[model samples]
Target: MTRGDSTELAAALRQWRERLTPADVGLPAGPRRRTPGLRREEVARLAGVSVDYVVRLEQDRGPHPSSSVLGALARALRLSAAETGHLFDLAGVAVPGPGRVNDVVRPSVLRLLDRMQDLPAMLVDARTDLLAWNALADALLGDISAVPRERRNLLRMRFGPGGDEHHGPVDEHGDRGRLDRSSVAGARAALARYPDDAALRGLVDELLRSSESFAALWAERPVEDRRVDRKAYDVAGIGRITLDCDALEVPDDDQTLIVYSAAPGSPDAEKLDLLRVVGLQKV
Candidate 1:
């Protein structure tokens, strides 16, 4: 590889690493130590790389890191999506494009989630991966964090089993067919967006083979606009409540910010408020 800003890249990585603590990454703070931030070994463990590799990168004493390595480092450091892109650029690696699913949520989108405290808000990538969600969303749509990263997909929950009852697309209104069609159409749109992504392709292929409905829908190639829709959810302890669901697309990142809110002063709104309080305690 051609020599680039090795020193600058090293410095940047060190700065980011030094600014983050173990608690930020869901690790215990433990007893006080000499280092202000995490150690190189801790970073390596979190990033799924070896201590030697992290040392090499930080000391500017080895070859350039790969895209996957950089991605792991970005996640380990809790960098914003934009910061992750910058990390790739600093390493002379091309940023992931539209043809790839970007799981990272923009900082602006996160801020919006924070602002919508009373409403249920979530962010999902093109592949339907649950990138981020608010507490209200966890209450209304079930806890996305409880599932494995690969299985935290809306379409998967839709066609899979009743086990994911809380996370499944089915509402209290018994609209399984409608929800299935929407999932199929959403999958089609994702396929059109990232035709070359192997993971996405594998998912579609598996669905086509396993689900006859999915196969039929794939044949039809129907596309639906899910920007705004009405949904009724049967949340535990709250019975059934209908809410207005709006999906705001972030075209640049190929992600969608989905927000669900009940009408103000409606009975459903009051139930949602109660859910928020209960959900906070449960989560």
Candidate 2:
């Protein structure tokens, strides 16, 4: 980036940092604060960077950071997807393309997840990486948060080794071929969107190399959004329960928010309420 761009980026980072408070990020505000919002140390901690690095970034004196670091910063600052894209531009880096997947959740999306207290809701990017999920989602989807961030992709879990280990409601569907087709199509769509994304390319390559099923399906070139009407689960305590599944699109970020709900006042609804309590405890 040019010197002017670097200066502007530093200014923007400082502005975002100063405008947010500890409470905004779910942190405790300590005693005897000097400046407003979260401290630079707190930002560094949240972004998983050193305090010195954060200072250099704010001062426009450090070397340019990688896209991953920028993504972490964007999430720590609670930036919208648009704002995150702008931050990357100023930092002399291109925003994540279709292939370059990042799991930075938008603040508005997080708010939406918060509002769905009863049903299970999860947010994923075009790459199908699980970004943010509510407690109920964790319960119904087998606690994606339990996995390492990189391994949280749905395509990976569905086809890779130990795939059937996740004892979630979706596992009860029994239609493996349909699920595989949908996954391949989703991955293809992401590839089409970001042909130049190395990480995305790597994921595709890895899947193709590892799974004969994935390779054969990819060769067929099937394309469609996989939305199913009803999903059944055999919970130990709840026995058999079914719910309607909907995949909503957040067009701004090219992300999908999956929501699972049952009919009101039905037996499934009562069981879902019981599972909500179960899910909250697991989270």
Candidate 3:
């Protein structure tokens, strides 16, 4: 990277960091006597880097950051797609192209989730990483916020030991098999689209080593995309409730917004209303 690029990058990083608050990134706004926006240490922690590294970068003395580091910082700062691209440019790093899976959820998409307050909705990337979810989804699908960010993947939860603990039970109509197959098929499609995504490749490798069921499904070489389906969840106080799960595409980011809803005036709808009332207490 050129010296001019490094200076611009440093200034840009500082400006971006100052424009955000702790609450924006789900961090606690602790009592303090400090400046506005997130502290350097908080940014470091959120971006999975050292405070010294962040400091060095802000001081215009750090080495050129890798693309992965830039991506992490982008997410940590909740940067928009354009802003992320600008960050990569300022760092003199090649912005990830269409060949890479886009993990950044746009702000407008998040607003869409907020508007669907009565319904259970969540955003997942192409590789099935659980990025964001609404409160109602937290009630219906168990407390996903409890799951670590790295461990909040659909495939990982489906195949990992004790995975079913949070998801409750599937319906008796063989929907479980279909969902599993769909997940595998979606992963296969993502692999085809983003052949160079190391994280996606690593997830596949981990699953192949850990899950024989995944291995069998992968061997089948399913290549279908996710589609609308019916799924059942046994809420604690409400018993079994089935909802129509719809996969809405955010094509620009290669993300899908999964919304769960029940037919109007149906018993499932009543159960969902009850869930809304109870508000994750029984979850």
> lDDT tens digits, residues 1-283, model 2?
5623888998999999999987676455779789987899978766667889999989989788888778878877889878988898898887765445656677887777767877888777777777666667767766554565567778887766666565323533655576677778989988998888787788899989998888999999998966655677666566777888888988667788889888899998998999977755664
Local distance difference test values of all predictions, in order: 0.75, 0.77, 0.80
- How close is every model to the real structure, measured as TM-score? 0.72, 0.71, 0.74
lDDT of 3 by residue, 181-234 (tens): 777898898898888999899999999998888889999999786478888988
| Residue 201 alpha-carbon offset, candidate 2, angstroms | 1.8
Q: Give the candidate order by descending TM-score.
A: 3, 1, 2
Ranking by lDDT: 3, 2, 1
C-alpha positional error of residue 22 in candidate 1 after TM-score superposition, expressed in Å: 11
Candidate 2 yields a Cα-based lDDT of 0.77
Highest lDDT scorer: 3
TM-score: the better of candidates 2 and 3: 3
Q: Report the Cα RMSD per candidate.
A: 5.3, 4.9, 4.4
Best by TM-score: 3
Candidate closer to the true structure by TM-score (higher is better), 1 or 2: 1
- Report how far residue 78 has shifted in candidate 3, in Å: 3.9
- Segments of candidate 2 deviating more than 4 angstroms: 1-65, 81-92, 97-105, 167-173, 233-240
